[model samples]
Every structure is written in structure tokens, then in C-alpha cells.
Target: MAERRHTDIAVIGAGPAGMAAALTLSEAGLRPVVFDMNATPGGQIYRQLAAPQVDATLMGQEYIAGRSLVDAFVTADIDYRPLSRVWWLDRDGEGYVLGVLQQGHSQQWHADRLILASGAMERGWPFPGWQLPGVMYAGAAQILLKQAALLPSAAPILAGSGPLLYLLAWQYLQAGRPPALVLDMAPASRYRTLMRHPVRAWHGRSYLLKGMRLIADLRRAGVAIRQGVSGLRASGSDALERIHYRHAGTWRSLPGTLLLTHFGVVPEPQLMRSLQLRQHWQHEQQCFVPDRDATLSAGTNLWIAGDGGGIGGARNAEREGHLAGFAAIASLGRQPTKRRSATTRRLLAARRRDLAARPLLDALFRVPEGWLAEQPPETLVCRCEAVTRGELDEAIAQGGSGPNQLKAFTRCGMGPCQGRQCGESVTRLLASRTRRSPDDIGYYHIRPPVHSITLGELAADDFDNTNN
Candidate 1:
């Protein structure tokens, strides 16, 4: 039997958003339980910040700034559960029940009011030879660098469109290891979008300055950067040996042992989707975002914050967390103090300022079109089930209307990953083939057991359980 417990307020994820929410609630005299899948606090953006294995000087200021957040979180009175993965969330009467797996045991947690701050994940854009051993995501590479001071050998090639791709290249340069080449895949359409929003460029000048400085740094470090790149392909007999991409109407080949690719990031939507919450397709960002109100309230007993709600980065996430915490406090029948109200207003203003640069960044880093058209039929779309593009096309030709029908026909999403890696690609492909909006095509109908667990773990009863 699963263990059960209850809390007045609970916050999912221990990233910047969740930590901020919990801290705010704790300061307001409510102890919120925070569940984090990682072994430590500080989600991906601040990973290993508390006990960094790598050098702080090389990681830069943004990373070092997380120390204060993690330090406050550690010293707080909040209940922090590290290495605990919430696999299921269900509405139980007026409350919510979360099924969490930790240390090979299943436990259930109940919360009167919940705040979800689940962070984002790197978007997977598949191509030929992407399944090779030496192919990896730039985000994954950054994680390795942060957690283990690991760097790719043999001068890897970085290919993708996004600030993250360039950020990773800059980090490598800081570590005295530079990439062989950086292929910028941002299409020409990005300029038109930018031109249409000149005001956004002015509002987000700081962001633009930072991006320019990063590019200049890479150039000073002698890193080869190419723009308008497309048709990225990894080729080798076994591991990655060569990267092929098109630039300026010419196909160029670069021999490299590792190929790090990153298109962008999207909200991790499994838990929110499983709860049957409202979602809207964000065309500018090219992903689905959880629908919420001004206070980030999704329902009577739930609030969403951070990248899980939308990709507004760390500062935005922190302010949203404070707002959500205040909202949850108000929902509990407590009137906000005048000071708290003032703080809330300040947080709202700061959040808006933090997000001022978002429109410009979104337009500049938009995912390029023709992804499916550029992909060969043999390319693996769903790496979990080894589903190829041709197989999905055949299933679509056989009257498969949506992701669910295609899953039934081709087993495209029924795997260990459960559609995390391929869901966006699948949705985009269906929308392209059907000439419909992604909103019409919809996302996968996520069910319970968002993360896989063993039967033995589910049945274990000797482990320490909680009921409060």
C-alpha cells in the first residue's frame, strides 16, 4: 500500500521558482513541502550550485548568484524532499494527491493548496544519425560540465538556434576548450519578426548586449561561428565523426567527434497535463503553456509558476513564485498585510521588467521551419520506440488523425520517455500534414505514472512512510 500524508501547502520542484514560493510561504508562517527530483536543490539552471564540483570562476556570475537562493533554501524551515520524483497527481475532493517515488518506495502526498514550478527541458529536434552515441544536447553537455567538470574532447561541433547553444559555447571557451564550429540555425524570418517589434529591442537592450558580448567573446577566442545554417546531419560509421550543414547555399562538412545540438527549450508539461489543467499554444515560443490568471492561479487549489507555466527564465520564475505564494496565502483565508501587499506589487513590477526582453529573444531564437521536410524518411522521430519518420508518415496516410491515434497505430509514444522527447515533434508533424494549428492537433493525453517505476518498488512496504 502507498503511504499517505497531508500538508497545508505543497510546492512541486525545487528550482528557483519553487524555492522562492516555499521561502515566501515559510516567511508568511506556512510551512510548504517542496519536492525535487534531483538529489539537491537548485534545478537545472542552478544545478550543483550548493555543492559545486566545478570551479566557480569558470561557471560565471549568473551561476554564482544562485548560491544565495540555495543557501536561504537550505536554512529555511521548509520540508525539502530531494531525489523524490512525483509520478502521478490526482484531484482528491478539494485537495490534490501526488504519488511520489523515492529510494525505491512509493509514497502519496496530499496538499490543500499546491504550487507547480516544474522547470523546462531541452527541445529535441531529431535528424539522421542523431541516435548515434556521440550525439548529445548542449544542455546535457552543460549539466556534465556543471556536475563533473566534464568537457567534450576532440573539439565538438555545436549546432542549433538559441541563446543556450551560444551560452554553452561561451562556457567552453571560459574553460579553455572551444568548439570546432558553431552553426546558427536561426532562419531569415527572425529578422522580420525583430523588425516588426523595434520597441521590444529597445526594452530588451541589456539582453541584446549580453548576446553580442557572448558572440564577440567567442570570436575573440577564435571559435568558428556560421549563420543561416540548416540541414544539420551527423554522419559516422558508429559514433559521431562528421557534421554536415548548409550555409549560404553551400553544403559544408566538418569532421568532429561530438555533435552537440540544441534547438531550444519548452515547458515540461506532463504533470500539468495529467491534472487536466487548461493549456494554450504559444505561437511565438512554439510550445504549449499552462493557462493561468494574474496571480498564477490555475484552479481553486492550484497555482503554477516559472518555466512550467511559460519560459520566462529564472528572475521571472522567482517573482512568479512569490506571487503564487501570496495568492495561496490569500486562498487560505488570510488577509495580506499592507507590507506584503506592497511586496507583491514590487514583485509584479520586477517580473514585468524581467520579461520585457522575452518577446525580442523569442523572435530571435525561434525554431526554424521545414524541420520535418529536411528530415529524411529514415530519421528516427521517436528514439524511445525507434519510430522513424517514414513509419509515422505511413500511419498518418492510414487515417491517423492525432497523436493518440498515431500512438495506437505506430507505438510512437508508448515508451520509457512517455513522449517527453518526441511529443513536440509529433505534434508539429501532424499539424504540418493536416494543415491545422498545433492548438487543434493538441498534445498527448498524459496519464498517471509520468515517470517509470518498478513493480517491486511499488509493492515495497517496509520503507519508512509518512502520514500527517
Candidate 2:
């Protein structure tokens, strides 16, 4: 049965942004109830270390910083619940009601203000043989290493752009398991786009140095790197046998059992979109982001923070969370005139400087035209229903009105993933064939129950009255 729970503040996700928000709000004398689907608090970026008393040096400075954030959140005066998945959001008087599934039981969690820090998901890079058993995301490989301390069976062949691809290879190299090959999607001329103001670049020189060091470390470990690479395909009759690619106007193949790739990341907006928040399409990030005020407030009762709201890294997300914490507490009618204006100003400035190089990153790591383009008729686009790309195209050709309308024809967005894996690809592929801009194409008409939960859980749930 569902239980009625009242929280002054409800923060979703336990990543850097969520933890930062909870910590800041706690300092301001508020107890925010935090719900994280992950068993631990660090979200993905700061995934908890292998052991409680392990050396932080091995995980690198990024995870070290994440450890500090997790520590702060751990000590905060907040009700922390791990392994809690929120599947629905509803209007509750001036506040909101969250349908949360915790430990296999449903509960109605209420709060005057809600903050979403659900984080981002890897951009899909569908290719031939991608559905094969061994072709997985580079981020997924990193997760195995981070959460379970597991390494690939054999040296991996990484094909993708973005710092994550490089970072993961570097981690493998650092751990004495250098990648077999790194097929970089970035062009040689990408450095030209990085031509930024000296002072601005110098302001973020530490990060710049880190990038150089990662590349240098990987090279030192004898990892083969091929830039401007394209035409990636994984082929195996039983398992992943080899990867084929075209490089320097020639087709080449690499003998490998695993092919890990990622173009970059985009916000996972299923929750935000389901709630019908104000969303805008960010050109650089090539995704829809929820719109919010300076305080991160979307409305009187809704606040969104972190990469789920936008694609800033952990540092920027933490800053946004801090600001949103204040906004949320004030919205809930709690304030003692305390503000972190100076800190917010500095964080915002640093965040801008940090992301100043993002356009270059975006250009360098962009998926090739049709990388997510319509696949062959037999190629699966919607993995949940086994819907193929040709089917999607045919549905579009059959005079489907838009992305949402195609659901009736092909059911692309109605899968268990609810369009996360195939949503962007479907929209882009549709726009390309229809000669319509993506803005004109529109997004999936997402409804409630954004995440999966058992019907038995909902059917047995108790509803709380909001009239009080």
C-alpha cells in the first residue's frame, strides 16, 4: 500500500547537483528529502568508490571532488532514500505530489517545491550490428569499472567523440588495461575552433592541462588513436567478432570482441517533459532543456537543476544546484535573508569559462550525418518493440503528422525506454526525410509514469488529500 509522506523540500537524484542542493539547503536550516534511484548517492559522475576506505588518488581528481560532495550530502540534515524511483508527478494544491516506488512499494511523496537533478544520458550512435551482444556504450564500460571494478574480457576498441570516450580510455590505461584501439570521431581541424581568448583559456588552464595529460597518458600506454574516423560497423554472427571502419579514404577492420562508442550526452528530459515544463532546444547541445529563472525555478512549485536540466559538467551542475536550493527554500516560504551572491557569481563565471570551449567540443565530437540517420528497413530503431528504421520512415511517409503521431503508426516512443534511446534519432531522421526543421518536427508527447513501476504498486496505492 502507498503511504502518505510530507516533505518540506523534495530533491530527486543524488548526483553532484542534487547533493549540492541538499547540502546548501541544509545549511539554510531546511531538511530536504532526497530520493535517488541509485543504491549510492554519487549519481554517475561521482559513483561511489569500490570500498569505503580506498585511496582516492586512483580514481583521479574528478572522483575525488565527487567524494567530497557525497560526504557533504551524507552529513546534511536530510532524509536520504536510495533505490527510490519516482515515476510520476502531479499537481497538489500549490505544491506537487511525486509517485515514488521505494523497495517495491509505492508512496505519495509531497513537497511544496521539487527540484529535478536526474542527470543526462549518452547520445545514441546506432550502426549496423549495434544490437550485437558485445557492442555497448563506452559509458557503460566505465560504469562497470566504477561500480563493480570489472574490466573488459579483452582490450576494447572505442569509437566515438566527446571527452568521456577519451577519459574512459585513459582510465583503462591508468589501470594497466589500455584500449586496443581508439577510433576518434574528431577532426584534425577541431583545434582551430578551440582558438579562444588567452586569458579565458588560461582561467581554465587546469582543465586544459588535464585534457592534454589524458591524451599523453593514453599515448604513453601504447593505445592506438585514429582521428577523423568514420564508417563504424560491428559484425559478428554469434558475438562481436570484429569492427570495420573507413579511415583516410579506405576501409579497414579491427579484430575485436567489444566495440564501445558514444557521440556525447544529452539531457534525459522524460521527467521534465512528462510534467510539461517550459523546454527549449539548445542548438549547441542539440537537445531540449527545461527553461528556468536565475534561481532555477520553473514555476511556483517546480525547480530543476543539474545536467538533466542542461548539459553542464559536474562543477557547473553543483553551482546551479546551490542557486536552486536557495530558490526552492524561498519558494517554500523559508528565508532568513541569507544568500550566497558572491559564491554564486564566482561559480557562474567559472562555469561560463569552463563551458566556453563547449562549442569546439560539440563540433569535434558531433555524430556524422546519418550516424543516427534512418537505418536499413530491417535495422531496429525501437529496441523495445523491435520497430525498424524503415518502418519509422514508412510511417512518416504515410502522412503522419509529427513525432507524437508516429506513435500510432510505429510505436517508436511507446517502448520501455519511452524514447530515450530512439527519440532524437527518430526526430532527426524524420526531419531529414520530410525536409522539415527539427523545431517544426516537435517531440514525443510524453505522459506520466515517466519511469517504470509495477501496476500492482499503483493499484494498491493510497492517495493523499491535498486540500489541507
C-alpha lDDT values of all predictions: 0.88, 0.79
The top-ranked prediction according to TM-score is: 1
- Residues 237-331 of candidate 2: C-alpha lDDT, one tens digit per residue: 98999899879879899789988898888988788888888777677777777888767788777788889887878887888788788777666
Tens digits of per-residue lDDT, candidate 1, 6-114, equal 8998899999999999999999988999989999899999998989977766876778888898899999999898988999999988889988888777888888889
lDDT of 1 at 427: 91
Among all windows of 10 consecutive residues in model 1, the one with the lowest summed lDDT is: 459-468
Model 2 alpha-carbon miss at residue 269, Å: 1.1
Q: What shift in Å separates residue 317 of candidate 2 from its native position after superposition?
A: 1.0
